[model samples]
Target chain A: MKTWIEKQKALIDFTLASLARRKIKNLGLLLVYTLIVFLLASVMLFTHALRKEAGKVLENSPEVIVQRLVAGRHDLIPPGYLEKIGRIRGVQKKEGRLWGYYYDGVLKANYTFMVPQPDALMAVESGKIAVGATMARMRGLVPGNTISFRSYSGKLFSFEVSSVLPNKSELVSADLVLLSEADFRAFFELPPGYYNDIVLSVANPLEVRNIATKLSTLLPDSRPILREEVLRTYESIFNWREGIVLVLLSGAILAFAIFAWEKASGLSAEEKREIGILKAIGWETGDVIKMKFWEGALVSLAAFLLGYIAAYLHVFRFSSWLFEPVLKGWAVLYPRFELTPEVDGFQVATLFLFTVFPYAVATIVPIWRAAITDPDAVMRG
Target chain B: MIEVSEVRKAFNQGRHNEYWALKGISLTIEAKKVTALCGPSGSGKTTLLTIIGCLARPTSGRVRLKERDISGLPERFLTDIRRSTFGFVFQQFNLIKGLSALDNVMLPAYPLGGDWRALRARAESLLDSLGLAHRREARVEWLSGGEQQRVAIARALVNDPEVLIADEPTANLDTALSKEFLAILEALAEQGRTVLLTSHDPLVVEAAVIDSVIDMRDGQIVGIR
Candidate 1:
C-alpha cells in the first residue's frame, strides 16, 4: 500500500513536470478550460444565490394572498372580502394591502408604491416618503430631498425622502416607495374600502390549502395564491431561465469539449514517442495508463478550482452583472444587490464529476489504446 | 539466459496484407555475454530482438528465461516479467523529449513502486557511470544524439535487469560514439549481465567483445558464427 501511494505520488510529480515542460500549450488550455468552468459556475452560483435570497424574503411573506379577479384580470379587492376570509378555520391574521405601480415619466422608470403598516421599519407621514436603496440611487434622491410624481389622475404630489432602505433588504425593497395609507390611496386614486389584495396568515400551516379552498368556495371571484405555490413558481422560473441559458451555452461547451477531446485524443508525434519510450523501458500498460490518468486529472482539477473560485468572486462580489439581465430579471431597472457567498458542496462535486470526469475518460481511451499497441511499432515510427 | 523455440509472428493475420515478420526460429542467449543479431533492414533483426525483449509476444512457440515459459502468459504477467527481467534500447533513441536526462533515467523506477529518493539515487549512480553526471539536468531535446543515446542507455540499465536488449543501439551515433556505446555494452556484459543487441554495422557486429553473431535473412536465421 505504501509503495502504491509512493508510486502514484511519483507519477503525479512526473505529470506535473511534464505539464510544466509544455507550459505554454498547457497554460493556454488551462486558461480556456477555466473560462468555460467560470461561466457555467457563475450562472449556477448566481441562480442559487437568487433563489436563496428570494427564499429569505419569502419566509416573511404572508401565507396566502387573496386578490379579486374581474373577467380573469386582477382587480381591486373590496374590503368586505377580508371578513369572509377571516371566518375561515385556521385563519391567524388578515391585513388589507394597498399597492400599485407608479411610473415616473421624468425618470422613465417604474416604482412600486405601497402603504406602510403601523409597525413598519420606516414611518411615513402624509407629505413624506421612504424609498428603497435602488430607488434612491436611481432617482438621485437622499434623505430630506423632495421628489415629485404625477398621480394617475394627473395630480402632482411631492414628498420629502424620509429614509432609504438598507442594502440587506435591497432585493425585496428595490424600487419600492412606502407612504401613509391615505397618501397611497390618494396617489393611486383608489376609493375607500378597496385594496390591491388581502394577505392572510394561517395558524396551522398544513391547513393553508384547506382554508384557501374554503375561501374560493365562499368568494368565487377571489383568487388565493398560496405561499408554497408562489415559491415553486419562483423556483421554476429561475430553473427554467437557467436551463435555457445552459442550453444556449451548451454550444460553447460542446465546442470546447470537442477541442479538448481532440487535444486529448490525438497524441502528437512527440507524445507518442514518449509513451513508446516509457513502455520500452519496462513500463507496463497499466503504468502508462496511470500516468495519462494523472495528466488528465491534473489538468481538469486545476481548471475546476480556478474556474470555480473565479465564478464565486464574479457572482458574489460583482453580483453577476454579466448574467444579471437573464437571471435577475428581464427589466430595464435591475435590483442593485450582491449575492451571499455560500458553497454548495453537492453542486461543486456534481460539477467536478460532470466536467472533469468526462475529460478524464476521454483522455484515458486514447492513452489506453496507444498503451496496448506494440511499443516496438511505435518506437520504429 | 534466454531461449526462443519455434517462434512465429504474423501481422494482419488472415487478411489480404497478411505477412509474417518472424518465422519458426530458435536461439539461445547465454548469460554474462554479449551476442549480436546482425541483418539488414527487412531481415527481422529488430523483430527477433523485440520478441526476446518481451515487447511483443510470439504468435506461437515458447520463450523461456531460466526455464520459465513466458510465451503463453497473460499480458499482465508478461509485463511483470518484462519489468523485472529485461530492459530495452530502441533504434531511434526514444527518450521523452521534454524531460531532463535524469528524469528519463528515473522513468522506469517510477512504476517499480519504491521511494523516489532511492530511485533518484539509483538513477544518479547510473548516470554517473555513463559519464553523464554533468548533463543530468539537460533536457534530452537539447542533447546531442550521442548524449541522448547515453541517456537512453542509462534509463535501460537503471532497473538493473538481468537482460539488456538493444535494437540498433548505434543506429544514430557516429563511429566514435558507436564505439563508446559498444564499449559500455561490453562493460555491462562483463559485469555478468546478459547483453543482446542488433546491428547491421560491421563496426558493431565485428566488435572483439561479442561472443557470437547470428545472421538473419527473411525472418529466419541464415547463419551463426
Candidate 2:
C-alpha cells in the first residue's frame, strides 16, 4: 500500500512537472478555465449575498400595509382612513404614509420620497432625510447637503440630507429621501388629507389577514398587503434581472466551453500516438485519468480565484457597474456598497462541482479513446 | 523464459479488408541468454519483437513469460509487467523530446517512486556507467544519434527490468557506434540478464556473441541457428 501511494504521488508529481515544462500551452488553458469558474463563482456569491442584504432592509418595514387600489392602480388614500384603521380590534398602531416618485432631469435619475416619523422604526430628522448609501455616493451628497428634484407634476423641491442609510438592500432599496409627513406633502404638492398608503403594526403579526378583512369592510377601495407579498415582488424583480444576465452571458459561456472541448478533442495524431506510447509503457487508465483531472482542476482553480477577486472588487467597491445596465435596464448611478467578502463554502463547493467537474468529465471520453487505441495503429502514424 | 506458441496476429484495415502481419510461429528464448532475431524488412521481425516485449498481444495463440501466460492479461496489467519486468529500446530512440538525458534515464523508474536523492543517484550512476555522464544534462534533441541511443538504452535498463528487448537498437547508428552499442548489450547479458535483440545488419549478427540466433520471415521462424 505504501508503494502504491508512492507510485501515485510520483505520477502526479511527474505530470505536474511535465505540465510546467510546457507552461505556455498548459497555462493558456488554465487562464481560460479560471475565467469561466471566476464568472460562475462571482455570480453565485453576489446573488446569494443580495438576498441577505435585501432581507435586512425589509426586516425594519411594517408587518402589513394597506394601499388604496382603484382600477388596478394604487390610488391615494384619504388621510382620515388611518384614523378608521387605527380603531380596528387587532390594530396596535396605524399611521398614514405619504410617498412619491421624483425625477432629477439633470442626473437622469429617479428618487423616492417617504414620510418620516420622529419615533417611527424608519424615521429621520425634520426637514432632513436619509438617502441610500449608493445614491448618496453617486450624487456626491452628504449630511447637511441639499439635493433638488422635480415631482411628477413638474414642481421643483429640495431636501436637506440628515444621514445616509446602509446599503444592505442591493436590488429592492430604491434611492430615497425620507422627510416628515408635512414636508412630504409640501414637496409633492399634495392636499392636506391624502396619503399613498397606511402602514400598520399589529398586536399579533399573524392577524394581518383579519385586520385586512376588517379594513376591507370599513374602506372597500383599499387592499391590504402582507409582508410576504412585498418580499415576493422584490424576489420576482431580482429573478427577472438574473435571467437577463444568464442570457447575456450565455454566449461567453458557450464560447469558453467550445474552446475547452476543442482543446480536448482536437489533439493531433502525434499526441494521440504519444498517449498510446504512455499506455503501452505501463500507465494505467486510472493514472491517465488522474493526470487529466489534475490538469483541469489546476486550471479551473486558478481561473476561479483570480476571476472571483476581480468580480468582488468590481461589484462591491465599484458598485457593480459592469452589470448595472443589464440588471437595471438602464444606466443608473449605483450607490457604493461595502460588501464584506463572504466566503460561502457551499457556494464554492457548488461552483467547483458545476464548472470544473463537467469540463473534467467532458475531457475523459476523448482522452480515454485516444489512450486505449491500438498501439500498432498509433505506431504506424 | 520466453515462449511463443503458434502466435498469429491479423489487423483489419476496414470493411472486407484484412492483413496478416504475423502467421503461426513458435519460438522459445532461454533464460539469462541473449537471442537475436534477424530478418529482412517486412519479414515480421518487429511484430514478433513487440509481442515478445508484451507491448502487443498476438491475435491467436499465447505468449508465456516465465510460464505466466501474458497474452491473456489486460492492457493495464500488461503495461505493469512491461514497466516492472520488461524494457524496450525502439528503433526511433523514443526519448521524451524536452527531457535531459538524466531525466530520460530516470523515466522508467519514475513510477517506482523512491527518495529523490536515491532516484537521482541511480540515474546519475546509470549515465556514468553508460559513458554519458558528460551529456547527462543535455536535452534528448541536442544529443547526437549515438548519444540518444545511449540515453534510450539507459532508460530501458534504469528499472533493472528482468528482460531487455531492443528492436533494431542500432539501426540508425554508424558502424563504430553500433559496435559500441552491442558491447554494452554483451556486458548486460554477461551479468545474467536476458537480452532479446532484433537487427537486420549482417555486421550485427556477426557481433552478436550470443547463445542463439532466430531468423524470421513471413511471420514464421525460418531457422534457429
Note the chain A TM-score of all models in turn.
0.96, 0.86
Residue A263 of model 2 has an lDDT of 73
Model 1 pairs whose backbones collide: none
Q: CA lDDT, every prediction? A: 0.85, 0.75
Given candidate 1, what's the lDDT at residue A59? 92
Tens digits of per-residue lDDT for model 2, A1-381: 777776667666767766776778777777777677656655666665665566566887887889899898999997678778767897887777777776666668877777765566677656678887667777888888997766667776677888877555434444776778777777778899887888888878778888878888998888889887887886777777777787788899889878876775566665565566566555666666666666666666666677778777766676566666655422265544555556688877787677767767776777777766655443332
What is each candidate's DockQ, to 2 decimals? 0.73, 0.52
Per-residue alpha-carbon lDDT of candidate 1 for residues B121-160, written as tens digits (9 for 90 to 100): 9999998999989999998889999888888888888888
Residue B84 of candidate 1: its Cα lDDT? 84
Top model by DockQ, which number?
Answer: 1
